[model samples]
Every structure is written in structure tokens, then in C-alpha cells.
Target: MVSQLDNPNLNLIPKPSHTVKGLIHIFTTAHRNFFTDVMAQALRIAGQGTPVLVVQFLKGGIRQGYKNPTQLSQKLDWIRCDLPRCIDTPHLDDSETASLRDLWEYTQKVVTEDRYSLVVLDELSLAINFGLIPEIEVLEFLAKRPPHIDVIFTGSETPKSILDMADQITEIRRSHTP
Candidate 1:
């Protein structure tokens, strides 16, 4: 059952639960500023005291740049954090060297240890597409995400499985005929 909402030729479907357990967003272009703004608004809707996990999917060089960490902190300043280095490198290349179980284990560690309000995976699709990260691990990460945490995945390309399971699917695209 696909539904549409008011937006730029995209679906702004309402979330089924105010306490959303997981979200997978597909952006067909590079729109970081817009994505971040919308995400902040969505997080605000989460139930009081509920933690949000955002998995941001950045494209191209953001991963190599290692800048999403600091920028995210500034972008979501309403939330507080100790400000650990963003985009921990171990998880970057390990997607190639490590198995899905290992990636799941690492994600479990971060989510549990940080007790994060949101988990953002930036440029996830790109990482998997480029073989920098394993697809199975990505799925496992999605599967194992806790109910208390809100998980978000953003990128230009998303896997069919992820899209199939999405409670809310948001797509950002340009108006070719506009």
C-alpha cells in the first residue's frame, strides 16, 4: 500500500507510530541541508524521553572527509553530547574486512554504549555499493535496532529489502518538468 503526501513530487507519508522504531529514507540527489532539517523536525515528534537513532548515509567524500561528526553536533545542537569523534573510522573499512555479525556487534556496542537519542548513518548506500561496507551487516544493523531507538537511513540509493520493511518512506527528487 503506497501513499503520497504534499511535497516535491515525493511521498511525505505519516509515520504509523509516534514511537517509530526504524525509518529508511531514499534521496535521489545530494541534499544534505534539506535532509538534516527534515530529520530534526521528525525527531522532535518522537515521544518524550524516547531515544532516536539516526543512521545517515553520506555520499562521495564525506566519509573520507570525516566531517559529519562535528557538523551533526552543530546541526542538532538542541541535543547534547560529549562530542566523540564522529564517523568512527573502524566501522568504515571494516565493512570490507569484517562480517555482518561483526558489524552488528559493533553497532550494538555504539547504540548501547552511547545510549544515543538518534543514530544517523550517512552515505550508507554508497558505502555498501562501493564495497566499503557489507550489505548483510547493514541489514543486520537494521534488524537488531532496539525499539527504544529511532533509526534513520538516508542516501540516493536504498536496498529493496530496506524499502520493503520501511514504516515510512521519504524520497527527495528534483522536478524535471517544473
Candidate 2:
């Protein structure tokens, strides 16, 4: 498969090498380590002294799947919105509310402020699908978002508008081979 980074259109915040820096979409129906894979790349970038922020909107109870090295303290920021399960929390209503707020606030800050080098919005597609966040709003945000900051969106379903606007897209699928 061709890497998204290989896409010529992805030159938004062109590196010295000329690469895009906004809206990376990774979708998958397979139960795989897509988040882990992306986080690993974020870690690598952070290692180089670039700021990285990762926010996971799902409340799966799994905390940051990666270790936070002290050396990268100021370089990396990771957060997850995994709400606990309980009868009172039917369908994660609380989580949905909390994440919607968090994503809105943080995402706005990231795009408008240009504080981080890379911002990974894990499971953001889920938020969009759940109607917690509007796709058009995000698209508008991206259009106005600083060109120097790179952002990523990961989940199973991707809207056509997003696909058309993105600089790169990587789709993950489960292997059926026995």
C-alpha cells in the first residue's frame, strides 16, 4: 500500500521536504493497533523535540497505550476520554457529553493557537458519526487552521468531504488469510 506521506497533495505545512500537515484520515473495520501505530510515529516526532498532542475520544478504559518518557515530558501530551461503564451510564451518555466538550475546546485551541507540531484526534470519526461533532465545522476549522500544524483523524467511517479535503488517507483492513 502507498503511504499517505507519499501523497503529493499532502504538502500543507510543507516540510523542507514539502509535506502536508493537516487532516490525516486512517479508517479501519479491523480490530487492530491503529492507535498504537500512530502514537508510535508521534513519539518518534516528539523525540526529535517537536511538540505532540494525542487525544483519544473513546472511553474504552485503556489509558495511554504508550509510555511517557521523562525525556519527552515537555514534548508530548496525551489524553483519553474513556469513561467508566455502569448502569447509570447507559450508552456512555456522560462520556459523550464530556468528550464533545473536550474535543471542541481542545481542537479549537489546537487549530487556532498552533501550539503543537502534531495533533492526533483518535476515534474522531466516531465522534462525527455519533453526531457529537459536525463534519462541516471540522472542515471549516481545517480550512482556517494554521498550515504549520499537522493534525490526524482516525476511525472506521470517513465522510466524503473529509476524504476530499485531506492531504493523505490510510485505510486499514483485517487480513482474512488463515
**Which has the greatest TM-score?**
2
lDDT of each: 0.51, 0.66
Per lDDT, the best of the predicted structures is 2
What is candidate 2's lDDT per residue for 96-154, written digit by digit as tens? Answer: 57644664676577658877878877776666777777888878877887877787877
Question: Model 2: clashing residue pairs?
Answer: 10-20, 11-19, 11-20, 12-20, 59-82
Cα lDDT tens digits, model 1, 1-178, are: 9896757635566556656444544444555446665566545644444544444333322232222233333224122111223332335443433432343355457676646656655556655766556778777866776555555566656678767766676766556644
Indicate the residue-level lDDT of 50 in model 1. 51
User: Could you tell me the C-alpha RMSD of candidate 2 in Å?
Assistant: 10.6
Candidate 2, run of 10 with poorest lDDT: 63-72
What C-alpha RMSD separates each model from the true structure? 13.5, 10.6
- Name the weakest run of 10 consecutive residues (lDDT summed) in model 1: 74-83
The global Cα lDDT (0 to 1) of model 2 is 0.66
The clash count of every prediction, one per candidate, is: 20, 5
